[model samples]
Target: MRAILLIDDHAMFREGLVLALTQAAPDFTVHAVSNGSEAIAELEAHSGISVVMMDYYLPDVGGSALLRRLRQARPGIHILVLSASEDPDDVHAALSAGAQGFIHKSASSKTLLEALHGVIEGKQIVPDTYAAIDTNGRRLPQSDDAALLSALTPRQIEVLRLVCDGLRNSEISARLGTSEKTVKAHMTAILAGLGVINRTQAVLIARRAGLFGKPN
Candidate 1:
């Protein structure tokens, strides 16, 4: 039997998907999971599962990074992404990280099933539309785009730019209309996402890489 795993966060959605798959192919045993980490654990626990259908966004692990890890752990396995995000950069990054197929959650149930069948038939897919933007989801700078832009998310990029402008956590919170803790968390994630040690370094590096130099 060709085995598969379904990874999504919503219980209702997972249950509905499981029902649909089992009804469509009774011989196919579909295991369901809640998030990327659990899906990783499931992959480790279950051998011979040939396909993985997952969402791109998870509370624990983000898209591109998770896709890379999944590919590294299960080379040659077919992976399909179902997401609401249509960010062009995200699409490119997911494909680059080794996702075999991509489909938006907004696709009809029939379309989703067809996409799954297509992947099973060795076809690659992506949404027809998406455009890359800066960390704020604004148009990325035409020139001097930072090397770090590839690493940081739109939210983290916003926080990093504010930090470079010498905004303190409280000031940043007020300016961005976010909580101080949230700003601080973004700062931390910005550093880790950039593979840097601290925010000060993160700002300087982003500026040097030319991402922060662009006008809003």
Candidate 2:
């Protein structure tokens, strides 16, 4: 049997989801909780839980921190975060902290189920908005671009531009005449300087800061 542990503070919505999930998947055993503490206790009590479906905002704990705690408790558990926020930072932070998928609360129930199934099957799921931003690469003001890019060193900027071009780390290393390890180190600094948690977010912020080109 597939088991799901859901953590959300809203009582009506949480109960509704539990009912909906059980009806949709007869083989699923869904357990519901309201906060971080209860979630921890439920997870500890139920060793068979395969998926954790949680709200990104909690009254008691921050999203990334709770995600980290859950991951530490169960290394192999699959986690999916649901939120009303479409913020790229939130999406990247959840993924960076260990969530396999992030779904906005505005999504249809069908979409949410599909994401859950995908995560359970070992797939990483990101929203269509993020995909669009990644593909289009929009530009912002020149001053803003200069200021954000200024945080990165010349080498870091070079590495980031290559990443924006979709080059793999190994390919970047070859192009820059550096080891893959060094490229990875540069990437870490780039992410920190850009205030993002992953390459996708880094690219989006770069585009927003006009790193790619002048505004269209």
Candidate 3:
């Protein structure tokens, strides 16, 4: 069984995640800690941990600094940040400091599990939304807009254009003569292709790419 080290400050939330993870993945043994010190201690005590899933905001230390220390302690260990922070700087900092993956706390359990598996397999997983921005929270340069626009299918482009027009999933479904579920799937694909996290980001990127006109 693969060992996982889970570090978060909240006792209740940590316990809840422990229970959820235990039930969801029986093949993994989870070691839980409430702060960065205990996390370091746990890491020193156990050499079998395959992944470290940590919260971004902790009372003991900043996320990026702690990530560096953890990486120093266990070189090449898979580290995944599970935080509620959607800030581009936080995402960039954690990854630059050696985190292999970052998952928003709002993600479903299934998405979390997939991220865990991806990290374990050495994939660098981050939300397209966060990945598309720089550390300063600015969108990436306009030069890549052409490439990004070219990556989408014509149908996905239509869905994205409708999205830029401020259409909801149901509205887009109605406009495209497709089900809401299908529109959601296309939106998901568009987000992944565009390296964005939400409809707003998608619209911004599309506008920058000249795939859609700017709002009045």
Candidate 4:
């Protein structure tokens, strides 16, 4: 049986995941831990760890640093990040740090198990919303201009993303508690920054390039 290590900060989330995964993949032996530090300790105690499902919001250490440390310690261990949503930057950073894949938190138990298996088999899985970025055990972008995504500030990018989602300026302003004019201004800047002509171009660029919902 393949040995899987689970790392998360919340007791309930970790336990729920454990129960779900155990039911789905009965042949796997799962070793659960609460954080990155505990993961290292577990590794020291038991060197047979094969796969690690980690969350980014741990108290002791976040997923990025934890994966980096894990890669340094055990290069063969398959690392997958448990994330709430498809975040471009998070997926990029995790894979850049040597994670094998990303599993969305809201995925069904069966999907999670499948993702674990896929990771074990060395496939980089991305959710439906993030299409531009590709993974080959590491997140290497298809285009270097995609790196310019970081130029826009977080909130500006957030508003621009809503526009890409086809949300009107009024709806965005209401949801974000900002003025319609403010939303329009952000959209203008986003278009200019991306060298796009309009909102349609911006949205297409964002989705095609995996620009939205970067893990914070």
Candidate 5:
């Protein structure tokens, strides 16, 4: 039997998901936990766990941080982020943090099951909205673009521009005449400043804020 772990803070939502998954795949075992710590404990105790479905918000640790920790601790386990947020940035951050897939909480049971199955089959799943952003490489700025841009430093903005252009850390460092370590530092700060968790999210947020200037 396949085993899956779910981590989310809301008891009602978690219980509902557990019930839905249990009914959908009766042969498979589903376990639910309410926080990162409990999720970690469950993972450690259950060696049969093959996939982890987690929420982007946890009471104990941020989603990205928890995702990173799970990746490091169980390198072979597949993780799928199930979040209520439909924000492109949140989806990108979950994927960047090593989640195999990202699905909105509002997704239908069929879609949710498909995502879980896809992750178990070694596929990366992203919602259509996020996929569109990835394909377009830019988005129109929202009304709050100015406020978001103001939070980032000029150097951080430069780093973010390269990131939006799909440059890796090494390439970014070379282009800026800086070390890769410095580039990473800039990325970290950029994520923090933008209230994002990863490069893809930062790029998405920047693009939507008109930081890339009409994509041409």
Candidate 6:
């Protein structure tokens, strides 16, 4: 069984997630805490926890700082940020601070499960829509720079578009009727062709290049 810890300031939200996670995976051992301090205590008390799901806003500490502290304390445990904000900077900050993934609170239950599983498997996860938002939460305007777009194959463009639509690799695979490995291959090519290091950056570049029809 997998041991998971959830940290959020709101009792209602934390309870709701507990129920949702229990329904999604019955074998998961979940512990919930309402603040960063309590979360640290919970971590100290539970040595078997494999993952920590945290909200970006906490009453006692900022999410990113707390994440950094947790990473320093327990480098092996995977930490995932669950935030309601769709700001690209927030996503970038959390991941840069050592979070394994950033999950929108609005994600469907199935998507949430997939994200947790992906993180447990040592994968970095970010919502596809992060590409559409600038640091100030404004949609990036389309650019006339077709140089990057022209370099990509049609199939890679297709994958990139779906990535902008906020689909995970597994979801993209189902949509394209391909295996996840094939989707990963396409992503690798897309990253190299775009000259970006990660999917989020690739999507942002594609959006700026007007590769996608409209910004979400």
lDDT of 5 by residue, 80-174 (tens): 88888977767766767777678889989998998888777655677766754642356433457558778888898888776654456876798
What lDDT would each prediction earn against the true structure? 0.70, 0.78, 0.78, 0.70, 0.77, 0.78
TM-score of 4: 0.61
How many clashes (backbone N, Cα, C below 3 Å) per candidate? 1, 0, 4, 0, 0, 0
**How do the residues 1-216 of candidate 6 rate in per-residue lDDT, one tens digit apiece?**
899999998899899999999988999999999889988888888889879999999999767889877766666678888999977778977865667688899888898898888777656677767655555566654454468879889999899877654456876898899999999999999888876667666655764565553222
| Candidate 1 whole-model C-alpha lDDT, 0 to 1 | 0.70
Sort every candidate by TM-score, greatest first: 2, 3, 5, 6, 4, 1
Per-residue lDDT of 162 in model 6: 72
Model 1 misplaced regions, further than 4 Å: 130-216
- The digit string of per-residue lDDT tens for model 4 on 87-175 reads 66676566556665677888888788777777676555555544443433333344644656678889977886555433557767988
Give each model a TM-score: 0.58, 0.65, 0.64, 0.61, 0.64, 0.64
Candidate 3 lDDT tens digits, 1-216: 999999998888889999989999999999999999999999999999868999989999759888888877876588889998988777766765667778899888888998888777655667867645655577666567768879999999999766543345776798889999999999899889977666655655665555554311
Model 5 clashing residue pairs (backbone): none
What digit string (tens of lDDT, one per residue) describes model 2 on residues 14-120?
99999888988889999999998899999999999878999999999759899988877776788999898988778767866778778988877788888888778
Residue 14, candidate 4: C-alpha displacement in angstroms: 0.8
Q: Measured by C-alpha RMSD in angstroms, how accurate is candidate 5?
A: 9.6
Candidate 5 lDDT at 19 equals 95
lDDT of 1 by residue, 104-165 (tens): 88887788877787666655555533322333444433344365567778888778766654
Regions more than 4 Å wrong, model 6? 131-216
- lDDT at position 116, candidate 4: 77
